[model samples]
Target: MKTRTSKTIGVAASAAAIALSVPLAVTAYAQPSDSDAPAAEIPDPQGPECGAFKEALPNWKGLADLPVSAALASIPEISTFNSAISGGMNPAVNITSVLDNGPYVVFAPTNEAFAELPPEQAAYLRTDAAGLTNLVYYHAFLGLLGPDDVKGQRPTQEGTEVEVTGKGGDIQVNATAKVTCGGIQAQNARIYIVDQVLDPAEAPAPITPTSTSATTSVTPTTTAPATTTAAPTATTEPAPAEAGAAEAPAG
Candidate 1:
């Protein structure tokens, strides 16, 4: 009986010791040195350009009101351009080539802005490479201009100039278009959010020469009436004047 009781007591004590040890082992494992654990990874929030502009200026109305000039100039990649102006500007479909440092001003329409243009103009932009390139240059100016800097008149890269004005508490540039909000300063760049997309200057209509037969007919008809009326009136007036003078002398 004594041996059985001792065996039972030993078993109970061993079980209690095991239960307590399991909790301690788990606690030690959980509290391992920080060097033994994996490091937390920080996510990148901004785009490829590793600037803090987006983070610093979270409230800025970026490119929402502006034409597509700044983004087109700054980011050369067409894919980035498409992504940047995805909202209302659809230049992605039409624009195959882009220019930044050329001697031309480009108002670069956004994907949405380009869509808003007439089908003919949009088609021309897509198919006509030389024309599109020239048009882009037409909107560019020599100096870097921000929203604040572009008030009043600005000369384009082309000889022609565009006027800038402020209205309704918004700054309006040429084409009577308004820039709602802007003034984002990037490295060696500035962005303005304009209200309307810019349009390329329209080509002048060709002058067609009149047909030779039509020209001859019009010229004779135009001269005949004046010649006939003038000669007859002059001769009759001289005779009447001489007769009146003779009658007065006799009286």
Candidate 2:
């Protein structure tokens, strides 16, 4: 009877050990490995000028189906540029139509940039049709150019060239204006928003002195001494005649 009791106790202990081991095995199998877990997604960093716009348009991939003019018009920051093109300020150049068909790269200046312009220049552009058209054309290029592709001088629709240079994360146009936002895509163009308005015609010509302005020679003037005439003495004349007569008599 004691042996039977000892056997039953051994069986019960074995069953408990097996039950505990089965739970541990199941827990181990259910846990996920590090490699099997999904990776966390990271977002790309935006340019300083585009950061706010990016946040505003979180779903914008690219305006690839829209025309260049329409794409620029959609962005509120570049409203000044949109208005210039579509406002009919330049009847001769149809800027809006030109942009509609382009495989062009456009450097758009912001409303603040226009406001920062010398008030006279901004006013002049608003009224002068041809001048405004040329100004707008100066900012456009024939083909699509991203930040990486923008280097050296590129010709614009206005028949002028814009000097492009890039260093680190910054891009400069015409050696003065910096590209604040870049690589914006449209159906037929790439757009870069610049901090300043680029005017090829308004760029000051290199200072060169004319041939007539050679070294100036100063001629010094000589002043003659004042002549003083002594009061004629009747005695002096009498003295000359007397002296001649005396000499003749002495000889």
Candidate 3:
């Protein structure tokens, strides 16, 4: 899929262009904490009996036995993702095949998650098949990634890799998009239903009581003013200015 370059056309051009536009203040996708929490802090949803790598365990119906394409298509929650991946920019760009050939981990965004994206824009990408196709590859990992194995930077069909963090049930993609449901297995792929679509941009990088302390360096405390407000550094002024952030839409 990396060979299928992202074309700068229609909505695709706008998506890529935003990367070089003014770096806006985005906090939605930055690491939730200044530092990674101890592994124990993150919760694992499955009971003690289930382990990440254990044999398929129980999945919805018998999805594990089905082909990756049919498995995902059967799920109602991620219909938007399935629909887009089913089609291509044309016959030449077959994304469905890329996903079908696993062991791939597809981070499928739910319908509500897709709704969070700009309505017109999201629908357009589904048809134009460039912006979302790049994003689809960006979200996919070409191997079977179980809960225990989901951490660390994973390669994608797209050029840029996604950094997955967290433990067990609390796993996240790029340390933002919460995996609402995971460990769904298909014959060739493992599907993870995520609450948020981890877009390519740094989440557009919260909140607190009273913060009047001044520090010379950028130090993110366990508690802070807002996601966008960091301590004023020695060389720069700290205004509530827009700095680059994550994928969620901005007002």
Candidate 4:
């Protein structure tokens, strides 16, 4: 009996130990290990060109005091545009004077945008005075327009209107060019960074055709009166011949 009781106690203790160890084993397995933890997200590194561009922009406090032309001159991203305006690419346009004079909204294209242009067109614009002048003027609007004012049709300095449309928070000009960075303020005007260059040749000129049509209509009217007078003379002469025939028959 004594041996049996000792054996029963040993079995109970063994069972209890297993129950405690099973819970501890499960707890140890459930806890996450260092290797199982989520990895930290790596940040995207800035490109060299982008870094240089950011460094070239004026500091926040000083930007407001600078004129639009000066502000544009300070940014490396738009250096191509600034150079075109200042370097006499278009002799007729005084871009510096225009930017200094008033409240204009300039849609400045990035250097990348210029580089993306077709080689032939880019070459022509680099040397063609009229084309360059028209191209620059097409991007400049007369008054200051913020992002909110950018919607709808707006007249450009080139004497033509461009269509501005906003959809899902994206703004597009002429349904082709898009505004990348907008509402940048300067002392004389606002500057919006655009992805593409605005071409004046693409804008519609309805007035020219309408004027031509008016001129063509007047030309036909002037010629019609002369034709009518000649027709009457021919009829009069034929009547006289018919009278002469009647006189001949009587004789």
- Among these predictions, the greatest TM-score belongs to 2
Model 2 weakest lDDT span, ten residues long: 213-222
Q: What is each predicted model's overall lDDT from 0 to 1? A: 0.43, 0.73, 0.66, 0.69
lDDT of 2 by residue, 1-251 (tens): 99999999999999999888785544345678797899543223224667776766564455656889888888888888887888744444458888878889898998889889898987888888888888898889777766776665656778766777783248887778988778777778888888898887754332233556532111123459989999977653433455446454564
Off by over 4 Å in 4: 1-58, 88-93, 167-169, 204-251
- Models 1 onward score TM values of 0.39, 0.59, 0.54, 0.57
Model 4 TM-score, all chains together: 0.57
> Candidate 1: TM-score?
0.39
- Give candidate 4's whole-model lDDT: 0.69
Off by over 4 Å in 1: 1-108, 167-169, 200-251
lDDT of 4 by residue, 1-251 (tens): 99999999999999999888785543344788898999544222122233344456536335557888888787778888887777555555457777778788787888999999999998898778788887888888777666666665566777776776773236777789877766666777767777898887676442222444553211121224444434544334343455446454564
lDDT of 1 by residue, 1-251 (tens): 99999999999999999888785544344677889889543222222222433444453344333334444443322222333233222344333233333322234333445456688876675666565545544445544455444554444544345565653235655545554433443323344444355543532222223555332112121224444444544334343455446454564
Using lDDT as the measure, what is the rank order of every candidate, best first?
Answer: 2, 4, 3, 1
Error of 2 at 173 (Å): 0.4
